[model samples]
Target: MTVQYKFPDNFWWGSAASATQMEGAAHEGGKGENIWDHWYKREPNRFFDGVGPETTSDFYYRYKEDIQRMKEIGHNSFRFSISWARLIPGGEGEVNQEAVNFYNDVINELLKYDIEPFVNLYHFDMPKEQQDKGGFENRDVVALFAEYAKQCFDLFGDRVKMWFTFNEPIVPVEGGYLYDFHYPNIVDAQKAFQVAYHTMLASALAISHFRKLDIKGQIGIILNLTPSYPRSQHPADLKAAHRADLFFNRSFLDPAVLGEFPTELIELLKEYEHLPAYKEEDLTVIKENTVDILGVNYYQPRRVKAKDHVPNPDSPFMPDWFFDNYEMPGRKMNPYRGWEIYEKGIYDIMINLKNNYGNIPSFISENGMGVQDEHRFLKDGRIEDDYRINFIKGHLTWLHKAIEEGCHTKGYHLWTFMDNWSWMNAYKNRYGFYSVNLETQERTAKKSAYWFKEVAENNGF
Candidate 1:
């Protein structure tokens, strides 16, 4: 049976991209080098196909045309990030007037076309200067981050109403410290704990500063929420699911929404003697300030079960110590991105928000698939991305169902608006509705873009 989805009134329909992934003027406008710039210089092959972030989709020079394409696609709102290093060279010393002017121009242009701009402060592009001084491992980085947030508010708050402090805060903890994907690859769980703590403190501090400024816009945090699915009804499976939730979702969810750390997480850290050092007043600050809104990015669910093998004492301690991923047979998958596609996971996330998170007003900040080698879909002047269209429609059906049942979801933003550079994946995966020709700087709307425009115009599918 096919279900029809009609979105709510004035629901935002758009897409999102980060500065580092889209804007390529890395050395222009007095921009300071980010960790990506430094790391790619050291190890070019670390990224896919030796593609660094020096020149992405060229949003820096092509935003004018890009904004026009967004209007053509019926995007009333677009969520993008401002580069901290671009705005302030050397992380915290001086503000770059050129960068400020550039961002102001982008924001004003978006507003001119009636497209609301959602600006995020950080999007995995830590300043190289900050990374050289220990990145998020050092507590001082939190204050430096807060200073950067303050500068952003002073420059763009008047036009930018939606502000996200950080995007997927736990990603750095897992990808950089506990895993070997990102830079400063350390396999220490204790350092991962410290980095996660510093990120939370930075988010809370940004919230506090936003309140002090009395900005007219709303401030929020963007969390990548993965609903954990237990393999069975057994208590062991449930326990494993709990640990996964605590580590990935609640680690950031609790502090940003409830203003307190999760008790189970704290107990686990204490048992391992891996708790991060915290000042006495830090908890008070977190508890006092909570976000005005929340951005939930749901790509997939975590299918977890009780670990069959016991933890080895020789291995470094981490979250995987208690749970193991359970791959169920006959489950639908997005083979293009190699990620599972569970449509109902969107409903589960919304229901959790309504029941446990005080029914806070939220939105689908990012939800889309990344297709490797998408050029196969290219057709006569446009890419026929019917699969991508179907992917979005399936999720929107569930999202609409949740809203009908009283979930406070305001809008839906896809993974991206155009093909841009990713960190490790580089430009390998294409999740955009528009195709960017690297050599020609030409923008062509895909078939999915036309379909999304109709959905946005009618508020339904």
Candidate 2:
């Protein structure tokens, strides 16, 4: 007996990609250097196997074929970001006509195949010049981002109905400020707070601008929401989990969706004197420009417990200072990525949105497992990615339940369309339905791709 798990009518089905991760031609076509190019030049070894983004899947020249593949695979929609450096060269001045033509062609190609284009303006690829000017740390950069977003709207808004201001905006804060994983690496809590604040403000400013343009589309921001679970029902553990949620998830969620910062988060920041310098007018702008839609990117959940030991009072502040990660025994894991496989986290997130966030329109923007050395799984002419298929099915099972309970969840998109270079980790883990051979720049659809095509055509398995 074949089990049928049909989704709602008109549900979106596709995958997501970012410009820097997929589009090569880093220097050609008048594309200025982004932070990825700058960082790779300085520290190539930091990237996986000495591979950088200079010539990533060569999607810059192969998008036509890629879109044809997408159509064949039954993709009804696709999400991708625009590189600020590629579009504006320096990130704030004259637009590059070549870049404009490239994006316009890509959008038209997707539309020609009856695929809806979901465009995100920023995806952590800051232009080198913008980073030199303090990136999102400087207040001036917020307005500059708004201008860039307005330009995108003016140029492609007619065809691109869905616009996202930022994708996983909190990532840069965690990667650059609190950790040494990203560019301009600075391990400072205060700076991290400021960066996060400004990014949220920039998103609101973009949303405000989008509304004023009278474009027939929905504008939102994509957030990587990891539900925080306590180690036990103990009060201390629960409190620790709550605080972690506020810091990592609610800090951006409340402002983007609810149009205000959580009072608890604000109070804690104020107590530490780590709040970003902001005017009353900025708060008003954020409050008045909440997103019309939301894009939830879920991969894993956070399991936490109360701090095992008191931190040194003199140590610099950090979110983990309040709580410690608790590795639950017997928890499922994605060994390649070292992330827990908790499909229920997706359902919990949907229910949370429904119960608390007014069940706003949204979709799964990015959810796919990355496997290290995936070439080992290749069979015959295709990669036999059964694990990847199971991964998607498990998550989809939970997502289906959420929708059954009236969760207003609109779609589910995988993390990527093809294997491409990732920042820092750069090609370390493959997370795509189509495996790309770097040497030949050839894209071969994995076994999961065939499975997914049927799932999309049938609306489910």
Cα lDDT of model 2 by residue, 340-367, tens digit: 9999999999999999999999999999
The collision pairs in model 1 are none
Error of 1 at 222 (Å): 0.3
Best by lDDT: 2
Per-prediction TM-score to the true structure, in the order listed:
0.98, 0.99
lDDT of each: 0.91, 0.94
Error of 1 at 351 (Å): 0.3
TM-score of 2: 0.99
Model 1 Cα lDDT, one tens digit per residue, 260-372: 99998999999999999999899999998889899999998899999999999899998999999999889999897778999999999999999999999999999998888
Highest TM-score model number: 2
Off by over 4 Å in 2: 1-3
